[model samples]
Target: MAASSLFAALDKDGDGKVSASELRGCMAAALGEEEAAAIVAAADADGDGLLDRDEFLRLAREADQEADEDGRWRCLRVAFAMYADATAVEGEGAGQHITPASLQRMLSRLGSQEPGLDECRAMICRFDLDGDGVLSFDEFRVMMHDGLM
Candidate 1:
Protein backbone atom coordinates (compact mmCIF):
# COMPACT_ATOMS: atom_id res chain seq x y z
CA MET A 1 0.00 0.00 0.00
CA ALA A 2 1.07 3.59 -0.42
CA ALA A 3 2.33 5.47 2.60
CA SER A 4 -0.79 7.64 2.68
CA SER A 5 -3.08 4.66 2.91
CA LEU A 6 -0.88 3.08 5.52
CA PHE A 7 -0.91 6.28 7.52
CA ALA A 8 -4.68 6.49 7.37
CA ALA A 9 -5.00 2.88 8.39
CA LEU A 10 -2.70 3.49 11.31
CA ASP A 11 -4.76 6.42 12.48
CA LYS A 12 -7.22 4.15 14.18
CA ASP A 13 -8.59 6.90 16.34
CA GLY A 14 -9.69 8.91 13.29
CA ASP A 15 -8.07 12.01 14.70
CA GLY A 16 -6.31 12.72 11.38
CA LYS A 17 -3.04 12.23 13.21
CA VAL A 18 -0.88 9.31 14.25
CA SER A 19 0.46 9.04 17.74
CA ALA A 20 3.63 7.26 18.74
CA SER A 21 1.63 4.42 20.24
CA GLU A 22 -0.23 3.89 17.00
CA LEU A 23 2.94 3.97 14.99
CA ARG A 24 4.60 1.54 17.36
CA GLY A 25 1.78 -0.96 16.97
CA CYS A 26 1.76 -0.64 13.20
CA MET A 27 5.54 -0.84 12.77
CA ALA A 28 6.65 -2.97 15.68
CA ALA A 29 7.12 -6.01 13.46
CA ALA A 30 9.69 -4.22 11.30
CA LEU A 31 11.00 -1.56 13.71
CA GLY A 32 11.96 -1.62 17.35
CA GLU A 33 10.23 0.53 19.91
CA GLU A 34 13.23 2.83 20.22
CA GLU A 35 13.55 3.15 16.49
CA ALA A 36 9.88 4.09 16.14
CA ALA A 37 10.21 6.64 18.89
CA ALA A 38 13.22 8.16 17.21
CA ILE A 39 11.38 8.41 13.93
CA VAL A 40 8.44 10.11 15.62
CA ALA A 41 10.72 12.56 17.38
CA ALA A 42 12.45 13.42 14.15
CA ALA A 43 9.22 13.84 12.20
CA ASP A 44 6.97 15.49 14.74
CA ALA A 45 7.52 19.08 13.67
CA ASP A 46 5.36 20.52 16.44
CA GLY A 47 6.75 18.30 19.19
CA ASP A 48 3.27 16.95 19.80
CA GLY A 49 4.37 13.33 19.97
CA LEU A 50 2.16 12.79 16.91
CA LEU A 51 2.37 12.98 13.14
CA ASP A 52 -0.22 14.70 11.04
CA ARG A 53 -0.74 13.97 7.35
CA ASP A 54 1.92 16.36 6.19
CA GLU A 55 4.48 15.23 8.73
CA PHE A 56 3.80 11.57 8.06
CA LEU A 57 3.92 12.00 4.31
CA ARG A 58 7.14 13.94 4.54
CA LEU A 59 8.70 11.28 6.69
CA ALA A 60 7.54 8.55 4.37
CA ARG A 61 8.89 10.29 1.30
CA GLU A 62 12.21 10.91 2.99
CA ALA A 63 12.43 7.31 4.05
CA ASP A 64 11.67 6.17 0.53
CA GLN A 65 14.40 8.38 -0.86
CA GLU A 66 16.85 7.19 1.74
CA ALA A 67 16.00 3.56 0.94
CA ASP A 68 16.70 4.28 -2.71
CA GLU A 69 20.12 5.50 -1.67
CA ASP A 70 22.15 3.87 1.11
CA GLY A 71 19.32 2.57 3.27
CA ARG A 72 18.73 -0.40 1.00
CA TRP A 73 22.19 -1.68 1.75
CA ARG A 74 21.45 -1.63 5.44
CA CYS A 75 18.23 -3.53 4.84
CA LEU A 76 20.09 -6.00 2.64
CA ARG A 77 22.67 -6.60 5.33
CA VAL A 78 19.99 -7.49 7.86
CA ALA A 79 18.16 -9.70 5.35
CA PHE A 80 21.38 -11.41 4.34
CA ALA A 81 22.20 -12.16 7.93
CA MET A 82 18.78 -13.65 8.49
CA TYR A 83 18.88 -15.69 5.30
CA ALA A 84 22.43 -16.86 6.00
CA ASP A 85 21.41 -18.17 9.38
CA ALA A 86 18.61 -20.16 7.80
CA THR A 87 20.32 -21.53 4.66
CA ALA A 88 24.06 -21.35 5.15
CA VAL A 89 26.04 -24.37 3.95
CA GLU A 90 29.20 -25.55 5.61
CA GLY A 91 31.45 -24.97 2.57
CA GLU A 92 29.32 -23.89 -0.39
CA GLY A 93 29.51 -20.17 0.34
CA ALA A 94 25.72 -20.01 0.32
CA GLY A 95 25.75 -16.82 2.35
CA GLN A 96 27.08 -14.85 -0.59
CA HIS A 97 23.70 -14.76 -2.32
CA ILE A 98 20.15 -15.98 -2.12
CA THR A 99 19.56 -19.02 -4.27
CA PRO A 100 16.03 -19.99 -5.26
CA ALA A 101 16.05 -22.89 -2.84
CA SER A 102 17.40 -20.71 -0.08
CA LEU A 103 14.75 -18.08 -0.75
CA GLN A 104 12.03 -20.69 -0.56
CA ARG A 105 13.43 -21.98 2.68
CA MET A 106 13.56 -18.50 4.14
CA LEU A 107 10.00 -17.81 3.07
CA SER A 108 8.82 -21.04 4.56
CA ARG A 109 10.47 -20.19 7.83
CA LEU A 110 8.83 -16.80 7.70
CA GLY A 111 5.38 -18.49 7.88
CA SER A 112 4.70 -18.94 4.19
CA GLN A 113 3.57 -22.46 5.03
CA GLU A 114 4.77 -24.17 1.82
CA PRO A 115 5.66 -21.79 -0.97
CA GLY A 116 6.17 -23.66 -4.24
CA LEU A 117 9.56 -23.95 -5.93
CA ASP A 118 8.27 -22.26 -9.07
CA GLU A 119 6.96 -19.41 -6.95
CA CYS A 120 10.35 -18.97 -5.41
CA ARG A 121 12.04 -19.12 -8.81
CA ALA A 122 9.64 -16.50 -10.16
CA MET A 123 10.41 -14.25 -7.23
CA ILE A 124 14.11 -14.56 -7.92
CA CYS A 125 13.57 -13.92 -11.60
CA ARG A 126 11.73 -10.72 -10.80
CA PHE A 127 14.75 -9.32 -8.97
CA ASP A 128 17.77 -11.14 -10.38
CA LEU A 129 19.31 -8.15 -12.14
CA ASP A 130 22.27 -10.19 -13.42
CA GLY A 131 20.00 -12.99 -14.65
CA ASP A 132 22.02 -15.53 -12.68
CA GLY A 133 18.94 -17.30 -11.30
CA VAL A 134 19.68 -15.97 -7.82
CA LEU A 135 19.63 -12.73 -5.87
CA SER A 136 22.89 -10.99 -5.14
CA PHE A 137 23.09 -8.41 -2.40
CA ASP A 138 22.58 -5.60 -4.87
CA GLU A 139 19.64 -7.34 -6.49
CA PHE A 140 18.06 -7.97 -3.13
CA ARG A 141 18.60 -4.37 -2.18
CA VAL A 142 16.87 -3.17 -5.31
CA MET A 143 14.03 -5.58 -4.88
CA MET A 144 13.44 -4.49 -1.29
CA HIS A 145 13.77 -0.78 -1.91
CA ASP A 146 11.54 -0.99 -4.97
CA GLY A 147 8.92 -2.98 -3.13
CA LEU A 148 9.12 -5.80 -5.62
CA MET A 149 9.55 -8.40 -2.91
Candidate 2:
Protein backbone atom coordinates (compact mmCIF):
# COMPACT_ATOMS: atom_id res chain seq x y z
CA MET A 1 0.00 0.00 0.00
CA ALA A 2 1.12 3.54 -0.64
CA ALA A 3 2.49 5.38 2.38
CA SER A 4 -0.07 8.16 2.00
CA SER A 5 -2.90 5.66 1.87
CA LEU A 6 -1.60 3.94 4.96
CA PHE A 7 -1.35 7.28 6.72
CA ALA A 8 -4.89 8.06 5.66
CA ALA A 9 -5.99 4.76 7.13
CA LEU A 10 -4.39 5.63 10.44
CA ASP A 11 -5.66 9.21 10.41
CA LYS A 12 -9.34 8.15 10.34
CA ASP A 13 -10.54 11.74 10.65
CA GLY A 14 -9.19 12.92 7.33
CA ASP A 15 -7.27 15.63 9.12
CA GLY A 16 -4.26 17.16 7.35
CA LYS A 17 -1.96 16.03 10.14
CA VAL A 18 -1.94 13.10 12.51
CA SER A 19 -1.65 13.68 16.24
CA ALA A 20 -0.31 11.33 18.89
CA SER A 21 -3.84 10.52 19.99
CA GLU A 22 -4.91 9.81 16.45
CA LEU A 23 -2.09 7.33 15.88
CA ARG A 24 -2.64 5.79 19.30
CA GLY A 25 -6.38 5.56 18.73
CA CYS A 26 -5.97 3.96 15.30
CA MET A 27 -3.54 1.39 16.65
CA ALA A 28 -5.74 0.66 19.64
CA ALA A 29 -8.84 0.35 17.49
CA ALA A 30 -7.11 -1.96 15.05
CA LEU A 31 -5.18 -4.20 17.45
CA GLY A 32 -6.15 -3.17 20.97
CA GLU A 33 -3.96 -1.71 23.70
CA GLU A 34 -0.98 -4.03 24.18
CA GLU A 35 -0.25 -4.58 20.50
CA ALA A 36 -0.72 -0.86 19.76
CA ALA A 37 1.70 0.08 22.51
CA ALA A 38 4.27 -2.39 21.24
CA ILE A 39 4.02 -1.06 17.70
CA VAL A 40 4.42 2.53 18.86
CA ALA A 41 7.36 1.73 21.08
CA ALA A 42 9.11 -0.43 18.50
CA ALA A 43 8.66 2.03 15.65
CA ASP A 44 9.28 5.27 17.52
CA ALA A 45 12.96 5.41 16.49
CA ASP A 46 13.37 9.07 17.48
CA GLY A 47 12.09 8.24 20.97
CA ASP A 48 9.97 11.38 20.81
CA GLY A 49 6.89 9.45 22.02
CA LEU A 50 5.03 9.85 18.73
CA LEU A 51 5.23 8.43 15.23
CA ASP A 52 5.60 10.77 12.29
CA ARG A 53 4.03 9.81 8.95
CA ASP A 54 7.27 8.18 7.68
CA GLU A 55 7.69 6.09 10.80
CA PHE A 56 4.08 4.92 10.55
CA LEU A 57 4.61 4.00 6.92
CA ARG A 58 7.76 2.02 7.69
CA LEU A 59 5.94 0.02 10.36
CA ALA A 60 3.07 -0.63 7.99
CA ARG A 61 5.52 -1.86 5.37
CA GLU A 62 7.10 -4.19 7.88
CA ALA A 63 3.65 -5.46 8.86
CA ASP A 64 2.87 -6.19 5.22
CA GLN A 65 6.13 -8.18 5.02
CA GLU A 66 5.18 -10.16 8.12
CA ALA A 67 1.66 -10.84 6.90
CA ASP A 68 0.07 -13.76 8.76
CA GLU A 69 -1.72 -15.67 6.03
CA ASP A 70 -3.21 -18.32 8.28
CA GLY A 71 -4.46 -15.79 10.77
CA ARG A 72 -6.02 -13.76 7.98
CA TRP A 73 -7.89 -16.84 6.74
CA ARG A 74 -9.16 -17.67 10.21
CA CYS A 75 -10.33 -14.12 10.69
CA LEU A 76 -12.12 -14.37 7.34
CA ARG A 77 -13.90 -17.52 8.45
CA VAL A 78 -15.03 -16.00 11.71
CA ALA A 79 -16.40 -12.94 9.92
CA PHE A 80 -18.27 -15.15 7.46
CA ALA A 81 -19.72 -17.15 10.32
CA MET A 82 -21.08 -13.99 11.85
CA TYR A 83 -22.51 -12.88 8.51
CA ALA A 84 -24.14 -16.30 8.08
CA ASP A 85 -25.70 -16.15 11.51
CA ALA A 86 -27.04 -12.67 10.81
CA THR A 87 -28.63 -13.81 7.57
CA ALA A 88 -30.12 -16.94 9.10
CA VAL A 89 -32.14 -15.10 11.69
CA GLU A 90 -35.86 -15.08 11.04
CA GLY A 91 -37.63 -11.91 9.79
CA GLU A 92 -34.44 -10.38 8.41
CA GLY A 93 -34.62 -8.95 4.89
CA ALA A 94 -33.95 -11.38 2.11
CA GLY A 95 -30.77 -11.98 0.06
CA GLN A 96 -27.11 -11.30 0.86
CA HIS A 97 -27.53 -7.50 0.82
CA ILE A 98 -26.63 -5.88 4.13
CA THR A 99 -26.80 -2.17 4.84
CA PRO A 100 -24.78 -0.32 7.43
CA ALA A 101 -27.87 0.92 9.25
CA SER A 102 -29.54 -2.47 9.09
CA LEU A 103 -26.38 -4.19 10.24
CA GLN A 104 -25.94 -1.73 13.07
CA ARG A 105 -29.46 -2.52 14.23
CA MET A 106 -29.01 -6.26 13.81
CA LEU A 107 -25.66 -6.32 15.56
CA SER A 108 -27.00 -4.21 18.38
CA ARG A 109 -29.72 -6.75 19.03
CA LEU A 110 -27.32 -9.65 18.68
CA GLY A 111 -25.67 -9.00 22.08
CA SER A 112 -23.19 -6.37 20.95
CA GLN A 113 -23.53 -3.66 23.54
CA GLU A 114 -21.58 -1.03 21.61
CA PRO A 115 -24.18 1.40 20.31
CA GLY A 116 -21.79 4.05 19.03
CA LEU A 117 -22.44 5.07 15.44
CA ASP A 118 -18.75 5.55 14.64
CA GLU A 119 -17.98 2.06 15.87
CA CYS A 120 -20.80 0.64 13.77
CA ARG A 121 -19.73 2.67 10.76
CA ALA A 122 -16.13 1.62 11.20
CA MET A 123 -17.10 -2.04 11.37
CA ILE A 124 -19.29 -1.77 8.30
CA CYS A 125 -16.75 0.27 6.33
CA ARG A 126 -14.13 -2.34 7.11
CA PHE A 127 -16.17 -4.80 5.04
CA ASP A 128 -18.20 -2.57 2.74
CA LEU A 129 -16.31 -2.12 -0.51
CA ASP A 130 -17.78 -0.56 -3.73
CA GLY A 131 -19.02 2.39 -1.69
CA ASP A 132 -22.52 0.94 -2.10
CA GLY A 133 -23.27 1.62 1.57
CA VAL A 134 -23.80 -2.12 2.00
CA LEU A 135 -21.93 -5.39 2.14
CA SER A 136 -22.20 -8.30 -0.27
CA PHE A 137 -20.32 -11.57 0.09
CA ASP A 138 -17.67 -10.46 -2.39
CA GLU A 139 -17.14 -7.23 -0.52
CA PHE A 140 -16.86 -9.21 2.70
CA ARG A 141 -14.20 -11.36 1.08
CA VAL A 142 -12.17 -8.30 0.13
CA MET A 143 -12.47 -7.07 3.68
CA MET A 144 -11.43 -10.52 4.87
CA HIS A 145 -8.24 -10.13 2.86
CA ASP A 146 -7.69 -6.92 4.83
CA GLY A 147 -7.91 -9.01 8.05
CA LEU A 148 -11.06 -7.66 9.66
CA MET A 149 -12.83 -9.97 12.11
Candidate 3:
Protein backbone atom coordinates (compact mmCIF):
# COMPACT_ATOMS: atom_id res chain seq x y z
CA MET A 1 0.00 0.00 0.00
CA ALA A 2 2.97 2.28 -0.40
CA ALA A 3 1.22 4.18 -3.16
CA SER A 4 -2.31 3.07 -2.45
CA SER A 5 -4.96 4.38 -0.09
CA LEU A 6 -4.67 1.32 2.15
CA PHE A 7 -5.52 1.84 5.74
CA ALA A 8 -3.09 0.89 8.50
CA ALA A 9 -5.83 -0.91 10.32
CA LEU A 10 -6.38 -3.40 7.49
CA ASP A 11 -3.13 -5.41 7.58
CA LYS A 12 -4.01 -7.01 10.91
CA ASP A 13 -1.19 -9.55 10.94
CA GLY A 14 1.42 -7.08 9.64
CA ASP A 15 3.02 -9.97 7.74
CA GLY A 16 3.43 -7.78 4.60
CA LYS A 17 1.13 -10.10 2.66
CA VAL A 18 -2.35 -8.87 1.81
CA SER A 19 -5.11 -11.43 2.19
CA ALA A 20 -8.41 -11.09 0.37
CA SER A 21 -10.12 -9.88 3.52
CA GLU A 22 -7.34 -7.39 4.19
CA LEU A 23 -7.51 -6.09 0.63
CA ARG A 24 -11.25 -5.78 0.97
CA GLY A 25 -10.83 -3.65 4.06
CA CYS A 26 -7.90 -1.70 2.63
CA MET A 27 -9.39 -0.81 -0.73
CA ALA A 28 -13.13 -1.40 -0.46
CA ALA A 29 -14.02 2.28 -0.17
CA ALA A 30 -11.90 3.21 -3.17
CA LEU A 31 -12.05 0.06 -5.29
CA GLY A 32 -14.79 -2.06 -3.72
CA GLU A 33 -14.16 -5.66 -2.68
CA GLU A 34 -14.77 -7.12 -6.11
CA GLU A 35 -12.50 -4.70 -7.88
CA ALA A 36 -9.83 -5.06 -5.19
CA ALA A 37 -9.97 -8.84 -5.58
CA ALA A 38 -9.61 -8.50 -9.32
CA ILE A 39 -6.59 -6.24 -8.96
CA VAL A 40 -5.03 -8.62 -6.46
CA ALA A 41 -5.58 -11.38 -8.94
CA ALA A 42 -3.94 -9.41 -11.70
CA ALA A 43 -1.00 -8.16 -9.65
CA ASP A 44 -0.44 -11.20 -7.47
CA ALA A 45 1.97 -12.57 -10.14
CA ASP A 46 2.64 -15.84 -8.23
CA GLY A 47 -0.89 -17.18 -8.66
CA ASP A 48 -1.09 -17.49 -4.88
CA GLY A 49 -4.18 -15.20 -4.84
CA LEU A 50 -2.47 -13.13 -2.16
CA LEU A 51 -0.84 -9.73 -2.74
CA ASP A 52 2.75 -9.85 -1.55
CA ARG A 53 4.80 -6.75 -0.74
CA ASP A 54 7.04 -6.98 -3.81
CA GLU A 55 4.13 -7.31 -6.22
CA PHE A 56 2.29 -4.54 -4.45
CA LEU A 57 5.40 -2.33 -4.65
CA ARG A 58 5.80 -3.07 -8.33
CA LEU A 59 2.18 -2.15 -8.97
CA ALA A 60 2.64 1.05 -6.96
CA ARG A 61 5.72 1.98 -8.95
CA GLU A 62 3.94 1.48 -12.24
CA ALA A 63 1.03 3.59 -11.12
CA ASP A 64 3.41 6.24 -9.81
CA GLN A 65 5.25 6.36 -13.12
CA GLU A 66 1.97 6.79 -14.98
CA ALA A 67 0.95 9.63 -12.70
CA ASP A 68 4.37 11.24 -13.07
CA GLU A 69 4.20 11.05 -16.85
CA ASP A 70 0.84 12.81 -16.92
CA GLY A 71 1.97 15.39 -14.40
CA ARG A 72 5.19 16.03 -16.34
CA TRP A 73 3.28 17.01 -19.47
CA ARG A 74 0.94 19.26 -17.52
CA CYS A 75 3.88 20.96 -15.83
CA LEU A 76 5.69 21.37 -19.12
CA ARG A 77 2.62 22.96 -20.69
CA VAL A 78 2.32 25.50 -17.90
CA ALA A 79 6.04 26.27 -17.92
CA PHE A 80 6.02 26.70 -21.69
CA ALA A 81 3.04 29.06 -21.45
CA MET A 82 4.84 31.20 -18.90
CA TYR A 83 8.07 31.31 -20.91
CA ALA A 84 6.21 31.94 -24.16
CA ASP A 85 4.41 34.89 -22.62
CA ALA A 86 7.66 36.33 -21.37
CA THR A 87 9.13 35.96 -24.84
CA ALA A 88 6.15 37.83 -26.25
CA VAL A 89 6.77 40.82 -23.99
CA GLU A 90 10.31 41.14 -25.38
CA GLY A 91 9.11 41.26 -29.00
CA GLU A 92 11.18 38.19 -29.78
CA GLY A 93 9.85 35.89 -32.47
CA ALA A 94 6.13 35.02 -32.37
CA GLY A 95 5.92 34.12 -28.66
CA GLN A 96 4.72 30.61 -29.51
CA HIS A 97 7.80 29.23 -27.78
CA ILE A 98 10.58 30.44 -25.54
CA THR A 99 13.25 32.72 -26.88
CA PRO A 100 16.85 32.54 -25.65
CA ALA A 101 16.40 35.54 -23.39
CA SER A 102 13.20 34.11 -21.93
CA LEU A 103 14.89 30.77 -21.39
CA GLN A 104 17.78 32.49 -19.68
CA ARG A 105 15.40 34.31 -17.39
CA MET A 106 13.58 31.11 -16.58
CA LEU A 107 16.81 29.31 -15.73
CA SER A 108 17.86 32.24 -13.60
CA ARG A 109 14.55 32.09 -11.75
CA LEU A 110 15.10 28.41 -11.16
CA GLY A 111 18.50 29.33 -9.65
CA SER A 112 20.38 26.36 -11.05
CA GLN A 113 23.44 26.71 -13.26
CA GLU A 114 22.22 30.03 -14.61
CA PRO A 115 23.54 30.29 -18.11
CA GLY A 116 24.75 33.58 -19.58
CA LEU A 117 22.93 35.16 -22.48
CA ASP A 118 25.62 33.89 -24.86
CA GLU A 119 25.17 30.33 -23.60
CA CYS A 120 21.43 30.66 -23.89
CA ARG A 121 21.82 31.90 -27.43
CA ALA A 122 24.00 28.92 -28.26
CA MET A 123 21.41 26.60 -26.75
CA ILE A 124 18.66 28.14 -28.84
CA CYS A 125 20.83 27.88 -31.95
CA ARG A 126 21.30 24.19 -31.23
CA PHE A 127 17.59 23.58 -30.85
CA ASP A 128 16.04 26.01 -33.31
CA LEU A 129 15.14 23.90 -36.35
CA ASP A 130 13.96 26.50 -38.88
CA GLY A 131 16.97 28.75 -38.19
CA ASP A 132 14.69 31.70 -37.40
CA GLY A 133 16.75 32.10 -34.20
CA VAL A 134 13.64 31.37 -32.19
CA LEU A 135 11.91 28.28 -30.87
CA SER A 136 8.36 27.31 -31.76
CA PHE A 137 6.46 24.70 -29.80
CA ASP A 138 7.62 21.89 -32.05
CA GLU A 139 11.20 23.04 -31.79
CA PHE A 140 10.83 23.29 -28.05
CA ARG A 141 9.49 19.78 -28.02
CA VAL A 142 12.57 18.59 -29.87
CA MET A 143 14.78 20.47 -27.45
CA MET A 144 13.01 18.79 -24.53
CA HIS A 145 13.35 15.42 -26.17
CA ASP A 146 17.07 16.08 -26.09
CA GLY A 147 16.75 16.65 -22.33
CA LEU A 148 17.46 20.36 -22.55
CA MET A 149 14.23 21.46 -20.93
Candidate 4:
Protein backbone atom coordinates (compact mmCIF):
# COMPACT_ATOMS: atom_id res chain seq x y z
CA MET A 1 0.00 0.00 0.00
CA ALA A 2 0.98 3.64 -0.26
CA ALA A 3 1.87 3.97 3.40
CA SER A 4 2.21 7.74 3.57
CA SER A 5 -1.02 8.37 1.73
CA LEU A 6 -2.87 5.84 3.85
CA PHE A 7 -1.45 7.38 6.99
CA ALA A 8 -2.46 10.84 5.82
CA ALA A 9 -5.99 9.58 5.33
CA LEU A 10 -6.11 7.97 8.75
CA ASP A 11 -4.50 10.88 10.57
CA LYS A 12 -7.54 13.03 9.99
CA ASP A 13 -6.47 15.69 12.47
CA GLY A 14 -2.98 15.70 10.98
CA ASP A 15 -1.36 15.15 14.35
CA GLY A 16 0.75 12.19 13.13
CA LYS A 17 -1.27 9.61 14.98
CA VAL A 18 -4.44 7.71 14.04
CA SER A 19 -7.11 7.79 16.67
CA ALA A 20 -9.72 5.02 16.74
CA SER A 21 -12.31 7.28 15.22
CA GLU A 22 -10.08 8.24 12.35
CA LEU A 23 -9.21 4.65 11.63
CA ARG A 24 -12.83 3.63 11.90
CA GLY A 25 -13.85 6.28 9.44
CA CYS A 26 -11.10 5.43 7.03
CA MET A 27 -11.58 1.68 7.20
CA ALA A 28 -15.28 1.30 7.84
CA ALA A 29 -16.32 0.54 4.28
CA ALA A 30 -13.81 -2.25 3.91
CA LEU A 31 -13.74 -3.64 7.44
CA GLY A 32 -17.01 -2.48 8.99
CA GLU A 33 -17.22 -0.44 12.19
CA GLU A 34 -16.77 -3.34 14.54
CA GLU A 35 -13.88 -4.89 12.63
CA ALA A 36 -12.11 -1.57 12.36
CA ALA A 37 -12.50 -1.05 16.07
CA ALA A 38 -11.16 -4.51 16.74
CA ILE A 39 -8.17 -3.86 14.53
CA VAL A 40 -7.40 -0.65 16.39
CA ALA A 41 -7.81 -2.35 19.72
CA ALA A 42 -5.49 -5.16 18.73
CA ALA A 43 -2.89 -2.90 17.17
CA ASP A 44 -2.81 -0.16 19.77
CA ALA A 45 0.14 -1.48 21.72
CA ASP A 46 -0.07 1.09 24.50
CA GLY A 47 -3.85 0.87 24.98
CA ASP A 48 -4.10 4.52 24.02
CA GLY A 49 -6.92 3.97 21.49
CA LEU A 50 -4.54 5.48 18.97
CA LEU A 51 -1.93 4.18 16.60
CA ASP A 52 1.35 5.92 16.20
CA ARG A 53 3.12 5.57 12.89
CA ASP A 54 5.18 2.62 14.04
CA GLU A 55 2.19 0.82 15.44
CA PHE A 56 0.10 1.49 12.39
CA LEU A 57 2.81 0.36 10.06
CA ARG A 58 3.32 -2.82 12.01
CA LEU A 59 -0.36 -3.58 11.93
CA ALA A 60 -0.66 -2.89 8.21
CA ARG A 61 2.37 -4.99 7.38
CA GLU A 62 1.15 -7.83 9.48
CA ALA A 63 -2.22 -7.68 7.82
CA ASP A 64 -0.62 -7.61 4.42
CA GLN A 65 1.54 -10.61 5.19
CA GLU A 66 -1.39 -12.57 6.47
CA ALA A 67 -3.43 -11.77 3.42
CA ASP A 68 -0.56 -12.77 1.20
CA GLU A 69 -0.30 -16.08 2.96
CA ASP A 70 -3.98 -16.59 2.43
CA GLY A 71 -3.66 -15.76 -1.28
CA ARG A 72 -5.73 -12.63 -0.83
CA TRP A 73 -4.70 -9.18 -2.01
CA ARG A 74 -6.36 -7.12 0.68
CA CYS A 75 -3.67 -4.48 0.94
CA LEU A 76 -3.52 -3.98 -2.79
CA ARG A 77 -7.27 -3.70 -2.98
CA VAL A 78 -7.31 -1.08 -0.23
CA ALA A 79 -4.54 0.89 -1.88
CA PHE A 80 -6.23 0.88 -5.27
CA ALA A 81 -9.58 1.69 -3.73
CA MET A 82 -8.05 4.75 -2.11
CA TYR A 83 -6.49 5.77 -5.38
CA ALA A 84 -9.79 5.40 -7.20
CA ASP A 85 -11.64 7.38 -4.56
CA ALA A 86 -9.13 10.16 -4.76
CA THR A 87 -8.94 10.36 -8.55
CA ALA A 88 -12.34 9.39 -9.85
CA VAL A 89 -13.60 11.36 -12.83
CA GLU A 90 -16.88 11.56 -14.67
CA GLY A 91 -17.09 9.44 -17.83
CA GLU A 92 -13.86 7.68 -17.00
CA GLY A 93 -13.54 3.95 -17.67
CA ALA A 94 -13.60 1.73 -14.63
CA GLY A 95 -10.17 2.61 -13.39
CA GLN A 96 -8.28 -0.64 -13.03
CA HIS A 97 -4.93 1.08 -13.50
CA ILE A 98 -3.28 4.29 -12.42
CA THR A 99 -2.86 6.80 -15.20
CA PRO A 100 -0.11 9.37 -15.09
CA ALA A 101 -2.52 12.25 -14.68
CA SER A 102 -4.26 10.62 -11.76
CA LEU A 103 -0.96 9.68 -10.19
CA GLN A 104 0.27 13.26 -10.50
CA ARG A 105 -2.89 14.47 -8.83
CA MET A 106 -2.55 11.90 -6.07
CA LEU A 107 1.06 12.89 -5.40
CA SER A 108 0.18 16.54 -5.33
CA ARG A 109 -2.66 15.88 -2.94
CA LEU A 110 -0.24 14.03 -0.72
CA GLY A 111 1.82 17.25 -0.51
CA SER A 112 4.28 16.82 -3.34
CA GLN A 113 4.89 20.02 -5.22
CA GLU A 114 2.77 19.78 -8.34
CA PRO A 115 4.44 17.18 -10.50
CA GLY A 116 4.47 17.84 -14.20
CA LEU A 117 2.86 15.39 -16.56
CA ASP A 118 6.27 14.39 -17.81
CA GLU A 119 7.42 13.65 -14.28
CA CYS A 120 4.36 11.52 -13.69
CA ARG A 121 4.92 9.69 -16.97
CA ALA A 122 8.50 9.08 -16.01
CA MET A 123 7.39 7.59 -12.70
CA ILE A 124 4.98 5.30 -14.52
CA CYS A 125 7.66 4.24 -16.96
CA ARG A 126 9.98 3.46 -14.10
CA PHE A 127 7.47 1.14 -12.48
CA ASP A 128 5.53 -0.20 -15.43
CA LEU A 129 7.26 -3.57 -15.51
CA ASP A 130 4.77 -4.86 -18.06
CA GLY A 131 5.59 -1.99 -20.43
CA ASP A 132 1.94 -1.01 -20.62
CA GLY A 133 2.69 2.68 -19.98
CA VAL A 134 0.41 2.59 -16.94
CA LEU A 135 0.57 1.08 -13.48
CA SER A 136 -1.45 -2.03 -12.86
CA PHE A 137 -2.38 -3.07 -9.33
CA ASP A 138 0.46 -5.57 -9.24
CA GLU A 139 2.89 -2.89 -10.34
CA PHE A 140 1.57 -0.54 -7.69
CA ARG A 141 1.91 -3.20 -5.05
CA VAL A 142 5.51 -3.80 -6.05
CA MET A 143 6.16 -0.09 -6.01
CA MET A 144 4.63 0.29 -2.57
CA HIS A 145 6.25 -2.75 -1.00
CA ASP A 146 9.68 -2.37 -2.58
CA GLY A 147 9.88 1.43 -2.70
CA LEU A 148 10.50 1.09 -6.43
CA MET A 149 8.95 4.40 -7.31
lDDT per residue (tens digit) for residues 1-149 in model 2: 68787688777677544556676676555676566666678888888766677787788778776677667667766665455435535666434555555566667768888467677667777666677666776777876566664
lDDT of 3 by residue, 12-108 (tens): 6887677777877756678777888887888889999887777877877877899999998887777677667353546544557777788888888
* Cα deviation of 45, candidate 3, in Å: 1.3
| TM-score of model 3 vs. true structure | 0.54
Error of 1 at 68 (Å): 12
Misplaced by over 4 Å in model 3 are: 1-9, 13-16, 85-139
Candidate 2 matches the true fold with a TM-score of 0.36
Candidate order (lDDT): 1, 4, 3, 2
Ranked by TM-score, the better of candidates 3 and 4 is 3
lDDT of prediction 2: 0.67
For each candidate in the order shown, give its overall lDDT on alpha carbons.
Answer: 0.83, 0.67, 0.75, 0.79
Off by over 4 Å in 4: 1-72, 84-93
Worst 10 residues of 3 by lDDT: 1-10
TM-score, each model? Answer: 0.47, 0.36, 0.54, 0.46
Q: After superposing candidate 1, which stretches have Cα over 4 Å from the reference?
A: 1-72, 84-92
Candidate 4, residues 31-140, lDDT tens digits: the string is: 77777778888999988888889888898889788878666467567766555423446465457778888887788888989989999889889889999777878888
Pick by lDDT: which candidate is best?
A: 1
Count of clashing pairs, candidate 1: 0
